[model samples]
Target: MAKKRNQVRRCVKKYIPYELHPDDFLQTMTKIFCYSRWFGVAGSGNLVWKIFGILILLLLAIIEGVAIWRVIKALAGWAVDIIGHRSVTARLAGTMFYASSIVTLILSWKLSSSWDELAAFWASVDQTMAINVPPDKNLKNRMISVTFIIMACVILEHTMCMMSQIGFDCPASLILKRYTLMSHGFLLLRTDYSIWFAIPLLFLSKVATILWNYQDTLIVTVSMGLTSRYYRLNNFVAKFSVAVKKDLSRNKQSNSLNSRNEYTWRKIREAYVKQAMLVRRVDAWLGGLILLSSLVNFYFICLQLFLGITQGLSGSFIKRLYYLVSLVWLCVRVSCVVLAAADINVQSKRALRYLYACDAHCYNIEVERLQNQLSKEYIALTGMGFFSLNRSILLKVRKDMAGAVITYELVLIQFDDNGTTAHIPSQSNATF
Candidate 1:
């Protein structure tokens, strides 16, 4: 039996490309997502696992719903007290945080629902590129490294935020109390909640945090994978261009060789088409996620900057440290997500450079077709058809954020100059 098994393994290895195996491609990410219950493994026939995944998702949904409800209730209370309280910043930040959490949870549910289509997309991408482009030798290591970095950053940020809230000077009992309240999303509720309730909410909050960070990590990882494929394709074209130049210079070009070059170009073109289609599929799957992530990141960044400028070294040491670390971390993470997605568009267009440089002898109908396809197609991820993710977006977002911060600062300065505070009007104060 062992001999027969070995023989079968050898036969399969000999005939099938390693990249064709869906399990091997993005294996680390697949494992992480599956373990988190955000996605199920493709082709799995385990009934119990599927049921368990469903239950886990349902539980998370219920928890998130409760958390959101609590946030809304807190917002209503704040609205009533807005005239007397100057805690606008805290309220806004908390609201944005919970709103972003809700968005991340929804994206997670979407991913779980579309796992089969996602699996098929991966399979198609692998089959398209496996024939000519060799797999990246360090892909697994790279993925693992990315996962590690994302996890470390998230864990550090969460810990620091929690500690900042609890304060370093507090006694153990007080610290524990504060931690429970914060984790249970009851800090803003201003009411005592049961320990039993807090414990479960704490666990659910941790899970929610994981899902939030994992969503961005997943986007970055998948973007890296797609960008690498396009890069490989571009490299192949470059090398082939070099060979074509050499043949033309040596006067060794012949009819058969020209035909072969054309055939290669045709194959590359077909692969390019497949890649573009795969990107569209990916965009469809992740567009809502990207849109929500961008909005949430933008809002928080603006809010953080506003708070940092207005507060400015006035808070506790731990609070100051948390603010600085979180701002830097958020900027780095957001930049990574944006640039990673943008590179897909950049890499897709890069092939055009090589195609244009092809030797005259090698240029043919296939070459022209490929050039046209590359030039005409605006292949990039989008925010649910609202906006394209590209280099320009980064610049635009930065500009807008700066403008927003400046405008907010001006408003505060005007309020201070008038010697009166800006406050939300109470119901009794309404004129109409």
Candidate 2:
């Protein structure tokens, strides 16, 4: 725990603020809206204050406009037509998500631009504006160059994954199933609910799956050389029995350690460590977003449960049906958050397990060094130091939700008017 504290303190460009205060609510909520928060911008420095001042607002508007344009194109099927692929709708959804992220980023930027501007905006607008959420200033200011890189990555990652399966002659049905999900999922997101609620639930679900699956992709690249060798030799592959067996069998003949000499073996080992380090760095950068999303998901779980017990029992048929649909969607989104958190932790654990193996040849000095480095913190999705995301955190969330629901239920009893409790004004969730 001290090491984790030190690890956080040492980060110079920390994107998450550790303080808890009035803005913490807005700080937590703002992260959901950031798409490229983790990536650094080029030319963020080197600008003359005058030139930057003149062009910054123009640049922001341009970026926000383009983001909206891309999203509209995607939602309207223009992207689908251009790409000519339906199987990777998640990719499309991701692309749109990143686009909205830009708009959100700008909103946050404007919100925190200066205290004066915020006060003026607030005065001009009504009190109910959702855009009034605050920004996390701990993020470094260089964000201009990051947008293109993220855009390319989203396009290529999903595209290449599908392409590789086709190249390998995997069954078309398997590919179609993954691709068709996004198209339908978006339609499901369009379900009749407050557009606000639908936005986070839908995007959070898709992004969570994308990031979660990415750990598998990361593990596979290293497992071919690093994890696979020892997982089998040390008999540490039981966490995921069937998938481990299948992957072990498929890669059974590809032992780089056996085929390559000590020099090449060291190279492979270094590559694996580098990949693991790279993954940790990315997680560190995205940790704020993950933390806020996880926290928000916790709130959603409580709200969903409360609505189920209250709305499901007393509301009209349409309201009940809406509750059922919203419940299912929220379940999917929360599941993705937990799965992403758990899988990343598990992948690191899988690598760490090899440290305890009996086979000396299956490990080495570099492996030991890597183990020590990982042991200090291991790989975790941390939220601005509020909490570390993992499987167990989900349990903690549910426990908290149970407690909050009981309290809310008791409160609703006081607010109840006559027999129907429907007259309660929907308090805009500050946490949302």
Candidate 3:
């Protein structure tokens, strides 16, 4: 008993140093297992790993199901047409969205199955722990390398697709592009975060599978490779950004700051200033909704990272909330694109109240003819261009602007009529 206790003490001393916090050992032993938190996911030693593997399968299935459901819901809606009214762009966007969703679902299913199989294999290996075993270092190394290569290639391909679809050349395009890229990037980042968590869990599971697997060398190598890849990618992105910034700075430096800058720059600056003010208004109105989402995502990322290291499952609620927020945003953006497309034939009517008898008669005749010809002419002018997916997205933005305008108008009306309370639209519910 004394020797056994000494061995345990030595083992704890040897193993516990890798923990970020000294208390992580205690936390790991006592804190709820994430798998166990979901009933039936934990069982006897072998079965636990098996069940854990199955849980992973279930998770992937759920994600795929949710993705499919979202795509189907996106397709089933009149919102797409009604909101993007008369837009060919909106229709194209609808098609693109459906295609993207299908592709993602398929990719996710394939990846999930691979992961499940790996987990099951490890679980099976663990079930026979009493038998003599060999290291099989070459096989293990190859497996790890293949797993990483597959993940890296898939991730790179997805990132390139995102860059092609969403990345733009200029500042104006960057606004929409940035959001699109970030949204998709966030999805990838979220997946990576899951991978980070799973790695440690798989390491522990492997330990339970065999004494040889408990050797830290393999885990360290795998982790180092992944970390190196991530760091290299991040550095590359940073350098690209630096290059762009340098070019912009050089361009600005080349131009005279005072003379041409004032004339050309002032006019352009004024236009942008006005636009900035309008954008600020929109952003201000959206602050509560989007800010909440950003905050939740921030929390999830931090908490998940912490949990991944500590073998704890804190902040899952926040993660789910973040996902829910993402879902909502996705729906809103899609709906907006559709609405904008459907609005292609929309126009304004004006009433002129001027006294000129002959001019009035000519105007009346021309106006009548114009009104009669308006639909065909307007339809021809807008065509599929107005129906374009981007335009549909723009129209959704216009709807938001319209709502803001309506809110301001209502406030003014209330102020004028009552000299009391002024109304503002609830920012929480406002959508673009």
Candidate 4:
């Protein structure tokens, strides 16, 4: 087991880059977006590629819009049929799935528009790290590892969903089914449109799906990056505190040492301020996307659970497996986003304990300022100025989702029972 673990670690280290600067944290994602033509205006591409990217973005917008309309139309038709609980739940799930595509498009557009500002923000962060934080290989490896893990999860989930929709079959129908599934039923809605159109539509659908998953991954990546800086800052303070204590105990403290410690404390305070400002800028840019992601994740989680409870036993084995995997994956992804953002808050306050641990001789005005700044200011990502993302919110969301699923299950049971009795005639009406 130990040997296997070591081999696995080596493989991971070999694949993931060793020297990842903070500014290049999103390089992989940028390449993906550029290739998919989802990020044209702000992407690093030639003039022709940029124009082609714009066209691709426009096409995606149209496709997603049409898909949303088709879903609404399908939902209306389903309501008319009024089959059962299963139909309603299935339709609702599909609606949310397609609706998410539009949301992803909006996020992608916003990111593209704000690319210049974001680039500047990253540059500023890299500059700060260069000046204050010493290079640490372990930190770089950890950040890249986190990013790779999240990306892997998303890609795996997408592949599974696609496979579930289009299982191994004959080559002729396989192409048809692949495009049909990607269309989200748009192709079916308008039979007059040639099947050939499904080719481009299918490609656009794949890109939209990438954007949908990438939004959350980006948030987690940026949060982890910010958290790393805070971790480094806290580590520095911890070491300084230890040094101060040792010097005092040995009765070797001197004016020169005191002066140096004071200067270090000042630099630490300045770095904190800069990081805090960067966090705010990031929040301003990503707050809307975060808000949308949280709400979308919450809705789908509940929807998936409701479907599982309603159809788990009656559904086919493959369907049960799909729902099980989807629910678990959704939960894991949301947790990554929430916990990663919350960690920023956790690491920021951690320095306070070390600051308080400093000896009297080592303590200075700068230390007090940092303490006040950290203690008094609440630093964490928020949902478009509405709610903050933290541990408390995560717990509350879990509790609420549980309550919601239970309530929905009970209501469904009652609904079905009443529906069954409504068809039966009274005995008086059946007299012979």
Candidate 5:
């Protein structure tokens, strides 16, 4: 029986690969053999590298946390200066957005470096496939595959967030959006790598969960939106500054009876009304898109949790709770959009105040032109479904002041200061 077994083994060896060097084959076998023995007996030197790698990852996570905190602090300061007294919840939401983004950034770094490490390791392995080191053979090989997979997923997600930030809507934006969305889908496939990279340290890490949740991508989108708001606000403040300057200069030109302030105010009011009307229309479309994306995200999280629980993972309880939390956030997002639409009424009130304040004789031409533009704008906003839904706004603005109901209504839409006149939510409101 021994002679027959030896003959079969020899036949298998001869057919395997003649190109493999005898020295390489021996080295590979020796390493595998040593790993099996070392794994059975603890405290082997081969385990030291694995311990070191884990420590490196943990340290990277800590650094990431600090960076995120700094960003949140900076954003908070900006928000305070801009809005001048936001609610507690707004601050907390900003913190979460910064926090989640920082976490994603750290994970991206780790995954990217890990991929590089794996490539080096893989090259070494292929060079010595037939001849491996005995002490850390299997230990090193296992990490190569794991790290490579993790790295690929993270890079894809980061790319998605970048594309979304560039104003993706339709045609040009739609093409990019599809690509960004595909990256998200790929990240979902590579989720197992994210899980492995995050969970071992027991920090309730959601690097993988958030990628699958598309939270990172959404945060990036919100960041872009916030940035857009910042620019608009800066422009408004600039225009406001210019208007103030013109008003100061006009006080000295009282004899002309038609100084620049009158002209500037009239022009500003007309421009403001036209832009606000456009904003009302865009708001409806933006609101719908956000709500739909939120729902999809909720569905994705729930499905992921269900799959995890069904597969008997240890964290099913936490996963389910997480899904519920995300669901609540989505509901809140929908509510914010609805409230924003309602807030248009308040915005129009502010516009009217500006219109009523203007000088009647010197600003008559500008005022008439602004009123005409407002009429056209009203048609635009009402046509977009936003104005129609909030039909009571005109009546309410008219009820508030009798002297110049139409005029006030026209101007107020663009001059409110409660963070909604711009029609874009402050970064404070959009985070997370």
Candidate 6:
């Protein structure tokens, strides 16, 4: 089984996109979107010259579109590698990750098609039964419409991009390196990677849970979504290790006793500070998104609980059960991510243990200074830097979960006593 796994891994590796020049795509976007391409005449020319420039720019835009397709194809290959289908579970996971998204887009589409029926139902239902209805009956329709429209645009554009990259024959490292360059080494505050990498993961996790099912789909999707966060952290650590090793080697070669080289030691010290700051920047980049997911998950868990209670209080026995099961499953799904995220934080801090345990004989003045800079002893992954994601969060969540359940139970009891459980009257009359 191990041999087979390795064989599959090898085969998969053989197919990854090679020789990625992501800058080309960036440049293409710049050209297409930049207004300078259409106006701002440099060389003296007649009115015909302006028209000629416009025509030429349009031609280039068409040509760049073709190249953009290739970039997309290359990216598709990269995404495939990231999905990592070397085992049965992995294959199923990749399939479900994508299939679920497709299914959600479809479900939204189907709901959109039945808008007329929904409209009629809303019209027939009086304001008394409209407890959940928006002030505008069309609000739900608009939300679904807008959501799917955006989804369609993204999906279409990405599809073209992916199709263009299929068998694109680009080197993955080159693509990433160029992406790093284009992104100014991730310091430019650009959001290309976040859009291309993070957004899809976010969308996938949400969509997978869109239409609840009693199966492993939720587990698979949450895991896949968190993979991006894990990958980013792992990538940073790898890069950080390489950086530290290089710094250590340089420190070891330096003469600590030489007063003349004191400035060099200062520069090395500065580099250590920069690296530490960069680690925080890495956190800032994706930390908010992960935190957002955590918050959303927590919100929904409470929501599911409240929904279960309210439905039960209102005599929706089956709905209450449905939500009860949903609440449990949602908690389970969230626990998986919280625990995984907590583990990530723990491992991230543990990366420093090796340095702490390193032989002190190898230390120089600069190295010692660098060590002091990192002397906090541990740095864990955080959610928006607001709080650390560790076993502590799990405990806090447990506490909060109990509070939320209690709060909802109290509210449900109050509503039941007040006879507000039937908050909305059922609509049986038809006027629409």
Ranking by lDDT: 1, 4, 2, 6, 5, 3
Task: Please say which candidate is ahead in lDDT: 2 or 4.
Answer: 4
Taking the tens digit of each residue's C-alpha lDDT, what string does model 2 give over 1-432? 676445433431122224322322223223322321222111122345325433433543443354355446655656433221221222233333343333333333332233233333323222222111233333222122222333344444434333422333446654443333322233222233344544444344344334332322222222222222223222322332233244445565544422222232233345345445544554544454554455444554554565457545443444344345445545554555566456656665555564554244444465566566557656555665677666787677767777887886565444332212221001111111
Off by over 4 Å in 5: 1-257, 273-291, 294-324, 336-349, 357-363, 371-432
* Candidate with maximal lDDT: 1
Q: Each prediction's Cα lDDT score?
A: 0.65, 0.39, 0.30, 0.61, 0.35, 0.37
Structural similarity to truth (TM-score) of each candidate: 0.80, 0.40, 0.20, 0.77, 0.28, 0.35
lDDT of 1 by residue, 342-371 (tens): 999999999888888776777799999999
- Model 5 weakest lDDT span, ten residues long: 420-429
**Every model: Cα RMSD to truth:** 8.6, 21.2, 30.9, 12.0, 32.1, 26.6
- Between candidates 1 and 3, the lDDT winner: 1
Task: Give the 10-residue window scoring lowest on summed lDDT in candidate 3.
Answer: 422-431
Superposition error at 230 for model 1 (Å): 0.4
- The TM-score leader among the candidates is 1
Q: 173-266 in candidate 3: lDDT tens per residue?
A: 3444343323322122222434443343333222221211111112222223222222322233234234334544556443332222223222
Candidate 6 to truth, TM: 0.35
TM-score of 5: 0.28
Better of 3 and 5 by TM-score: 5
**Which residues of candidate 1, in runs, are more than 4 Å off?**
1-23, 38-89, 128-131, 182-191, 251-253, 406-432
Count of clashes, each model: 0, 4, 24, 0, 10, 8
Candidate 6 per-residue lDDT, tens place, 28-119, comes to 21222232212312122346645654454343343234324423433345322211112122222223333332333333323333334433
lDDT per residue for candidate 5 within 114-142, as digits (tens), equals 33343343334334332111222343343
